[model samples]
Target: MKKTIYLIIIVMIILSWNIAYGEDLNLSGESYVLIDAETGRVLYERNAHKKMPMASTTKIMTALVALENGKLDDKIAAKGECIGVEGSSIYLREGEVLSLKDMLYGLMLRSGNDSSVAIANYIGGSLEGFVSLMNKKAQSIGAINTNFANPHGLHDDSHYSTAYDLALITKEAFSYEEFGNIVKSKSYTADREENNYFYNKNKTLWEYNGGDGVKTGYTMRSGRCLVSSATRNGMHLIAVSLNASNWFNDNYKLLDYGFNNYNRQFVYDSNQFIKKIYVLNGNKEYLNLVTENSLFYPFKEGERENIKLSIDVPDTIEAPIEKGDKIGYIYTYLDGKLIHEGSLIAKSTIKRINKFESIINKFKFK
Candidate 1:
């Protein structure tokens, strides 16, 4: 009986340890990173800051800028510069016209260099003007290490971005509804006068489950560059790979590792009851408090218990308090280090005592 109990206890300890740490993946890429889309938490990364040419993946920003600022229905005349510029093309004929939306699909799905130049000229009024917009957007989105020389990711000594910076750019782009629709599409049928059809160049969209977005790029200098996003179990993940030969395989590996190992656990649901806060000189002596928003943090399985939750409240607050008044905060910590925090708010209003009560107290008090 003693031996059996000891064995059970030992087994439990081992199981607990296993839950706290996830398996490490052998990701194949020159530089790569995986991040939580919602929290911007880095799940895994390797040499993510090494600047390298990104090839046509540069079109992601081009598509994003045009979608956000340019009118979709506006007809843009294809210029001479849009024809036979370099790299890939959707075969935009000189003097042909395409809607802003069609140009986007062509720019993204087909990696059309011609579409990029035409859109840039139409939206920015010049290629130089549009490149400035791309750089500005990159800076605004915390992509500090990125620079763009052209709307398309052509090989230029100065055209470069890091894996991490590209990940940040991809996240910013995903916030737009139309950007999401375009990147995730497998194919696009353009309503051009010539009738155009373009299929997505990002193969992970069809090959991997839950695979949605992003872009792919290739150049002799850039090698193979790819950014991809996926959703699983209510969690969204973005991955970037630069100068990698096995870009698609690496994305799959990183995503599977992220989805299987990490999970977002809600520490406190919105309006969940916490503790009653004392209210001095009010109709009620105390008011119940609760968290204002859902509080969540990522934790590996059995590590949930390691998260310490604490509440801070004043001794007592004067009344006439509103229902949503903040009285305290509940904070979560890991090994005494801060992890996440949420506001503790009053659940109900506490009105001040009547004037008659104040007068009676003043007369009766010794």
Candidate 2:
């Protein structure tokens, strides 16, 4: 369940399309969006939430499910589910067994539709089961507009996602070190099959600076769908373009806008003041609260006004409070929604007072 955090945006002209203050970017996709990989902020968007065909980009989530659920060394056999799927393939035959690592490389690098079925069947026990995991993962990641009817992202009227949803999915995929490493590789070789080789389809890896792992997709119905990620000067960005005539260029422009125009701004430093908590039945009546880590986020020019910080700490806590106790939270919001948060911890320990100590404290005070 998503809880709303109200933020007062002074600019009202771009509310409906999910646009924050950023450089004016012209893209060639029917639907496209840019987001902060760490913060999930929609730095720029056009028809972001409007659902459309995402084609092979659906494999991003498929790869994510595989990495999260299946062991890399787990041996998966090519079965009936993998036979003659549409689009691209690694040409796996029944009775052939390959490591999950090889299949993942094939799925992302070659966009192997057949490998998708093999993984879905082996890890999920069946195609339907894998599809269930896909949908559940989507919901878990707050991608409400996404639905995965197939693991390989072969076009189905029911299998569709918005640009915003795809970006969210890609960002989540990048969080996994294995997924991130796989997407960025220019080439991958099958560990079991010496002759098998796969090359990354995301052209941005070579054409764009700081290019990392991501996925590219296409179908006649979906046109060209591409999800691209990049890191530059400590800022990571995810760019999604759906039905694009020129996806590589569009993604390049999107990333450039994010890296060149915005920066990661620190709202709270580690050990920063949060609030004073009242203590009951303790040696001290109040305790200072602070954050354990610094909170930093990407923001565009003139967009700092959209960011708001709030501290929600209990008015009073019980005795025996210890240092580093998480008694509250420090939240950061953008456009009236929470973008980041951290625990509010006690700055110092406080001990409880026994009956004898209380009696002695009375005389000492006098």
Candidate 1 residue spans exceeding 4 A from truth = 1-24, 270-296, 308-366
Ten-residue stretch with the least lDDT total in model 2: 1-10
Q: Which stretch of 10 consecutive residues in model 1 shows the poorest summed lDDT?
A: 18-27
lDDT of 2 at 334: 84
* TM accuracy, model 1: 0.76
What is the lDDT of every predicted structure here?
0.86, 0.87
Error of 2 at 37 (Å): 0.4
lDDT of 1 by residue, 1-366 (tens): 999999999988877654332224545578888888876777878778888899988988898789778988989999888899888888998889889989999988989999999999998999999999999999988889999999998889999999898888888888888888998999999986664989999988999899998899999999998999998777889999888788998889888878888997767799999898666767776789898998666667887888888999887888899999988999888778886677999999878877787566455542
Model 2 misplacement above 4 A: 1-24, 283-285, 305-308, 333-339, 348-353, 358-366
Clash pairs detected, candidate 2 = 5-336, 7-336, 183-213, 184-213
| Reference-based lDDT, residue 262, model 2 | 94
Candidate 2's TM-score reads 0.87
Tally clashing residue pairs in candidate 1: 0
69 in model 1: Cα distance from truth in Å? Answer: 2.0
Q: Which structure among the candidates has the greatest lDDT?
A: 2
